[model samples]
Target: MTTQYGTWRKSRLSEANGACVEVARSLRGTIGLRDSKAADSGPILELTRREWTMFLRSIRAADKIG
Candidate 1:
């Protein structure tokens, strides 16, 4: 079966300098994410729903963490 990659959306925290990450949805139940700079060269990280939530939590707590 062919895999379909959905449109990529930039993060709301992105700046005007274009330094941000793009995320896309794959045909499977995985989320695809890549760097905005080296899109094609950068490796994509596919994460499940649970993993994604955990990642979000980590990012939210980044500032609180030492």
Candidate 2:
């Protein structure tokens, strides 16, 4: 859970006020997500590559319908 991540980036679709979430890709094929406002202290969400792919697909599907 405390693995060092690569470059952290926010989605281009993030809110203008900077209340956004950031994602990082680790070398081990895992993804890490954290609150942009608490990069240093906030807890990270770690997900395997497969899980991340599913999560993204679900979001895209939701966007298309909702």
Can you give the TM-score per candidate against the true fold? Answer: 0.80, 0.90
Against the reference, the lDDT scores of all candidates come to 0.83, 0.92
Q: CA lDDT of 1 in candidate 1?
A: 54
Question: What TM-score would you give candidate 1 relative to the actual structure?
Answer: 0.80
- Looking at model 2, residue 30 earns an lDDT score of 90
Off by over 4 Å in 1: 1-3, 64-66
For model 2, where is the 10-residue window of minimal lDDT?
1-10
* Model 2, span 1-66: residue lDDT tens: 459899999988889998899999988879998889998999999999999999999999999999
lDDT at position 48, candidate 2: 97
Q: Which stretch of 10 consecutive residues in model 1 shows the poorest summed lDDT?
A: 1-10
Report how far off residue 6 is in candidate 2 (Å).
0.8
lDDT of 1: 0.83
Model 1 RMSD in Å is: 2.2
